[model samples]
Target: MTTHLTGSRDEWLAARIELLKAEKELTRLNDDLARRRRQLPWVRIDKEFRFETDEGSASLADLFRGRSQLLVYHFMFGPDYKAGCPSCSAIADGFNGIAVHLANHDVSLTAVSRAPLAKLQAYRQRMGWTFPWASSSDSSFSFDFNVSFTEQQQREGSIEYNFAREPAFEWRSGKEGDGASARASFAAMTGTDMQTYTRDRPGMSAFAIEDGVVYHTYSTYSRGVDGIWSMYPWLDRAPKGRNEPSGPWWRRHDEYGRG
Candidate 1:
């Protein structure tokens, strides 16, 4: 039998009512944060970047697809990897459905990666996703955005990710320590080595166009992008509330054994 606490309906309702007050306060605070996010100053983008899309080739501005706003998911798929990151794949699974709704609302959502177009296409096909994905293989867009780092950056130990320069890790080809082992597991899942896996990091960026000028509005990396994950909000209300003591327990939808 389960050992979870049980209570009378009246007791449960009283506790729930108190929890509701906290939830409401969080909702209000979130609304204020969203307002502040929109009010943040945008940086003007002047670089002439190109990408390979299913539609052949396109410019960064073209990604807006005539919409005034663009949101790019910096998916962690490098040129050296045979597949997309498992974590990113799980996040992208929800995009196909939301992309349509966002497009109708004047925002275009696309995923940008450092992988070649052919590899991205194959992976997208395998995952059955229709969201627009563009390749920055020949462009400096990924580096400029700090989502893709170089070997030199790793050696210097001063790479900016998630907005701040992070300390260097003692990265090895196939290192076997706490962090290294976890990196190795993810790398193997994507059919790449640990070195290749660390080359690309996950992030999301927002852009806006005004008077034909493209401006970067905001970018978030690491756990900051968790709000975009469709599953988490639902799980937050569950009794166990993520219950992820063993780290990430999800895989690409197709990778799961359940039918």
Candidate 2:
């Protein structure tokens, strides 16, 4: 009854061996890329960046929690949004499990957002996550990292993210199921209009502290973050291989059966 390719066990093994060769090459290339990422020069961070955390107001250094390295996931929960981006939420679902291991390896991984600490805490509790989440609401930390943008920047097309300039968000009254409509639906899920919802973007940043000085080491955005998306690797191996014919057909984990 199946329309997929049917083959003898030996035939399948031969094809799988070919795929394994390519997979090995890719793994080696990724190792080389990681070495280059480490070789990238670190920029000293001199400005005072503060954050509100469960412990209280803390400096950027405080985020390291005695570790020499810090990894910040720029979560897209702007001050106006009633909820975090569903995409970011999906990515964050894996955080709690990894935090302890990363900490043991001399790295502190935290999620930073522009939402108020209280709001973030409420959302975190709702999601049953215990990983450290901090608020950059009263600081320029998110803006400095290029994850948060202003209304003026959005209007002027001056938003530079993922290491390139983005054109201003053009408003389109798209028909249902169009790109614009899909974006609008995501915005509504966050309880904001399209423009306001989009001002905050998602990315990750890395930092290092050496002898009392903090330095910005690396950052990545957009598809560059696919490596850290927990579900992607499994999906890549699935028979259907992500199976997203329409694009981004995922919801927050808990919302799967409600609709």
Candidate 3:
């Protein structure tokens, strides 16, 4: 009844041993990449960026919270949305548990969104999340970081993200399983249209402080953030390896099993 390959124990062990060699090589390569990321030149942040946090108005340096390292997850929750993006929410589900560990390691982890503080606070409470979240509602912090875009930029096909210019409207009509419909579905779940929903994208930025000066250290967007998705690493080691034929079957943790 099954068409999957079957092999003797010896054969399977031989194949697994070969795969282990490749995995070790990949692990070494990843280590080198991490080292390179740390060695990259840091860009000084001279412009002032502000945020609304539970503690009231805060500046970029304040985000470090006495730690030298600051990591901000650019959560996708634009002002127009009634809720946060499901994908961003999924990624954030892992944040609360990791925040304490990171803080102990001298890294402050926070989520930044373009939504107002009230909306973010309500949603954070609903999700039962304790991780620090800040609103960039009254600041150009999101735009400066290239995670939020303007209407004019979208109209003129000038939206640049992930170190590349995104096409204006082509992705909207892309075939199913290519992420177009999935994005639209996520937008609807967030009580927004695709355009408004996509105006804000997901990213994470790393910053460092030295001598009272703040500097941008690194950033990653789109698929580059896969390493931190929490579930994907486990899924990758599963028998079926992500197992999705229909693209993104995940929902916000609370939304699961309701349908």
Candidate 4:
């Protein structure tokens, strides 16, 4: 095994210089990534979708709420699901603060979910969030944007692709005692509409700012929820047992539960 030695002053200085070089390389890599992210093509969305807000029905254009631009977050809160996803809940928690700042910049942010207006409002109240959230109970918007699933697909235990061209699922199970099996039986309901057949493709929203609007800006599912938490100093804590995780404020936020 090759062990690193730190004995003389020259050796320590060399190690520090190497660390600074690594940091500079990291900075250069991050700049390259940002440029690549900005190079993604933008898609124009002209189709209008409807949603239910606190002020009643509103069109997708109306979601801009008379502002020049709008940013919609496709929050994961399907109708049949018992509660909003924990990971999504964490993001929504961040949105409360972000909404205020975005508005100050003349940008409006709204969260869209498949849950009914009443249900969403109740949960928002429970979470004590002030961000504007709307319900897409009547629109095929989620499916059109690929964020929800259909009833027939749920019943068939698979997803029909390309206008009934192909069917896909995780696994198939045999019927009781008959030994007859389906190819994909592990499918679950996407909790979307039945009539229009909306597919469940989570994270299908857009980000709009000055100059132009960007569709499907960025999306995430799980544990990476910690990605944005570093922005808040109060929430900035290292992982357990990594270096220092037993600071005074580490456990102080437990009273807030999952928030």
Candidate 5:
């Protein structure tokens, strides 16, 4: 008979102390990262942009909609694109649930896209989304925010890429075998999928509204998705992962089944 001796009190205490130390380190790192984020330099946006809302056409100021802050998710539905980006769609789905909480925080969140009002509305309906989405079809808003490209610029092939809105990722791989000892690896991909569109920029623009005027506060993209749905670990598994089907509650858009 073999009797394995359990760890003594001192060893258990030492292990717990180590865990506490690791936790403290994690907390410090998080605080430092947040402080660095706050220290990011700000750029002044002195231009006026336009958008079309359900009420009517309005300037960037109008997006505030009587709120103190405006957070706009630069959705990846270009004016000429047939559909919205799948990743952007995923983000929108999550936004539908948090719009109310944002309102409580005095921050108005909206999704903005380069598509025309009618087209955007159609897609929004297909997705069953109720969150506010506006159209920047007629304005240089998208181009200014590095989310759009002009036809002439595309033709010239000298268009400046919007690094601010591009997605980035890291990939790794390994081989596996008994005799060969295969290695395995993983990759982390970020940013929006802008390949379908002629232009490849997608980002979020945040504005602060004061006294009936809107001021561009901050804008971010690529890893910005990390702040939204990606923050929820379980969300990564929806649709194909662990999410259960809605049965009859789900309906396919008429347009989707045609093809």
Candidate 6:
């Protein structure tokens, strides 16, 4: 009763073997790209950026936590959002498990958001995540990274994200196609208006601290983050690889049965 292609044992094995060869090639190419990523030059961070965390106020350097390398997952939990973005939350669900191994491997992994420390703490408790989550509420950290935008920017269509300047997302007279519906749905989930919901963006930034100077090594956004998504790769091997037609077919790991 299968709806997909069916084949005899020998034919299936032959196809699988061919796929395995391509998979190995992709793996090698990924390894090469990773090496190139590490080779990207570093930009020194000179501004005095501060954040509020469970450990109290800390500087950008403090985020490194004695490790030379630091990785920050830019979580989308704006100051006005009642809850975190479902998509960002889904990505963050895997953070706790990786934090331990990364800490031991000379890297500190942290999640940074524009939400207040109190809100972040509350949400972290709700999600049962023990990894360090910090607030950039009192700082321009998110703005400097271009993951957070302002009302004027949204109105003027001057939003910059994913390393490109694009029209800001405004629900009223803007947004097109599935992007609009996805924004509306996520906005409702966060208990905020569409404009406010789109104020923050999701991304990852990597830094390296050498001789007490923090350097911005590399940053990735949009689909570049798919590697860390943790599930998409597995789904790619499934019978229907992420067969989402209109919008995202995912939710926060904690919210799977509301319907």
- lDDT by residue (tens digit), candidate 1, 169-222: 433322322365567778898898876788788889999999999999998887
Residue pairs with clashing backbones, model 3:
none
143-162 per-residue lDDT for model 4 (tens digits): 66545667666556555332
Model 4 lowest lDDT segment of ten:
178-187
> Tens-digit lDDT track for model 3 on 86-110?
8889899999899999999999999
Quickly count the clashes in candidate 3.
0
State each candidate's clash count. 0, 0, 0, 5, 5, 0
Across 154-239, the per-residue lDDT of candidate 2 in tens digits comes to 88999888787877874221222337767787888899999998888889999999999999999998766778899999999999
Pairs of residues at least 3 apart in sequence or in different chains that clash in candidate 1: none
lDDT of 2: 0.90
RMSD of each: 3.1, 2.8, 1.8, 9.5, 9.5, 2.3
Residue 226, candidate 5: C-alpha displacement in angstroms: 2.6
Q: What is the lDDT of residue 246 in candidate 1?
A: 34
Q: Candidate 3 — which residues are off by over 4 angstroms?
A: 170-177
Model 6 off-target regions past 4 Å? 168-177
Model 3, C-alpha of 131: deviation from truth (Å): 0.3
For every model shown, what is its TM-score relative to the native structure?
A: 0.94, 0.95, 0.96, 0.61, 0.66, 0.94
Candidate 5 regions with alpha-carbon error over 4 angstroms: 1-27, 39-44, 151-200, 235-259
Instruction: Give the clash count for model 6.
Output: 0
TM-score order of candidates, best first? 3, 2, 6, 1, 5, 4
